[model samples]
Target: MVEDGHFWTETNWVFIEVETDEGVVGVGEANWTVFRARTVVQALEDMERFAVGLNPFDVETLRQRMYNGNHFLHTPGVVQSMVIGAIEMACWDIMGKVTGQPVYNLLGGKVNDRIRSYTYMHYKWMPPEPPEKAAEAARHYVDKGFTAVKLDPVRPKEGPRNPRIDELEYAEAAVAAVREEVGNEADILIGTHGQLYTHSARRLAARLEPYDPLWFEEPVPPENFGELREVVDSTSIPVSTGERLLTVHQMAQAVENGVRIIQPNVGLTGLLEARKMAGIAQAHYAQVAPWMYAGPIAGAASVHLCAAIPNYLLQESLEGWNGFHNDILEDGLEWDNGDLIPPEKPGLGVEFDRSVLESYAGEYRPESS
Candidate 1:
């Protein structure tokens, strides 16, 4: 059944453990926010047929083979990308361990020492806050030193099939309140659940422009390239998208179609393709802001990718879950003044406490339950 749309994360994940003959094991996660975790795991297991015995150092060959060997799983959605991405991440981990260098160093070293972090004000499954409370929340985040925050002032899609006049009023009030509260101390990111049609999106964009948001994210849904371009053309506010998009080709299309910021999830596109995409976007003068709402393994991988890319922008981090997320990893990441300092340790700089796999086994259960 359809429900409220927010950026709340679903925990169910497919984990990859790549073991070397030398007894070194690298960890990776393939997160599924919209699909079944077990199915992704099954897909990953199936992919082992192509992965086995391949030179772990030559990850590009295996990465290409994993994406190509399965004809039925090509480019439809996150399923194929997540499966291949998990293995690719593990490969990087292995490569880092073998080379005695951090993953970012292997990627030609860091362009940044610390990457800026951006987060949502209210996420999925949380009750919606009124305009005043929304403003207060924005203030609190700023007080905590977060220079950027994202929010969707629009009502839940499950509530209305179309935009209501009153809903427009509410949306305006929310942005107005946040803008007033934060003033110039922070950047307000207006996020749509991709619920708005072309005109409704334009209306909201025009109303919010006076407040000066960092960008308007996915005002229209991902599948509608034409509508996405329409929204981009309608606003001077730089438009951003591509979390639902998979692979270098899809992201390339989004950039060519006028998306100023490309948000690639490290768990989906993996580091290799995302690195390639970042290079591509940099040459075209666009930015790559790695989007992650998954485990710390994926987050660490994104941090490495962002560190290595010159055109890197903000990274998405789940606000409330940091404590528990960090607990699951041996050397977890932390936020300092809204920036996460990348680790210089070998590989992607994250090592999992294997016990977390058993402790959080519930996330691996079937979706039907």
Candidate 2:
């Protein structure tokens, strides 16, 4: 039961830089829980054999070998997927640098010039009151020109606290407050961190129908596709999931089961795999909204992806615009009236700052005994 805090914190992002022989460098990211950031760094170190001399343009060939070459890492999950994703990400970045074109252009150019973006606000972030501050936090982002916001007020039952009735009250009040404040001009996304029982979650979804939320995110855990399908069928609110789903097979199965929106993380699926998932989503009339908790590299990659995706709904970004990400790149990412503009610069359109990366080198991995 991962919460929004896992995506909000800045101390757990892993970055990868693949430098070309001609003095050009490309950047990528491996986004996961803080606890696994070190292991991802080590995985990247172990990948030097595969990545050292690979041609940046031969991304698919490299990805195939990376997946098939390793006997233990044939399937996609957190560890292997993050490692493969980071490698492919850097390859695309390097290609962009070599060709002098934005990654989006290489992916097939933009369907829309501006990609819509969204932000998440915990119910207790500002003003610290569960239901009362919901509207305030929503309004704060709205005032900043963001038109979409997400929050999860329901605590997972695993927490030893399962006040079902009270949880519904708090969740309802918070969403209602957000609706009242932002009105229909903005979209409200309801999150649950896959916490509630489908039967009860169905009833809760009905209760929230009045607020006209964009979707109910991960109402139940992501595993039970059959049960998740039932929940989606039972609810009027569009159901969304995919953060924990690792492979395209999982994503396609969920979408086929009727997930209205598919979220593929660049750090989890890599750009190419994520793009394939997006295409799968589009084939089913669904949309792709890349979820990110990694630093600006992931953010930049998502923006590039959104540019080329016809069914891109919106891009999720950290609310605070944490400097840990921005400080590492010269032209990280900028927001303009709730939309992201694709950069004209080539090769993922961002620079790597080795100084900031080295400062936290010790935290990247544990010392070998």
RMSD of each: 3.6, 3.3
- Cα lDDT tens digits for candidate 1, 1-369: 012322335566567898877777777889754556667876777777877777778888887787776686554467778877888898899899988989999887988997888878874212256789888878877887788988888966742135778888888888898899999989999888688888888988888889899889888888878878998999889999978888888888888889989899889888888998887788789998888878778888999998898999899877733666776778777678889888888988887776975786555445565
- True-vs-predicted CA distance for residue 358, candidate 2, Å: 4.6
Which residue pairs collide in model 2, if any? 96-347
Off by over 4 Å in 2: 1-11, 123-128, 156-163, 320-322, 353-365
lDDT of residue 367 for candidate 1: 56
Quote model 2's TM-score.
0.91
Off by over 4 Å in 1: 1-8, 33-35, 74-76, 123-128, 158-161, 363-369
lDDT of 2 by residue, 30-68 (tens): 877467766677777877688778878888888888787
Candidate 1 TM-score, true structure as reference: 0.92
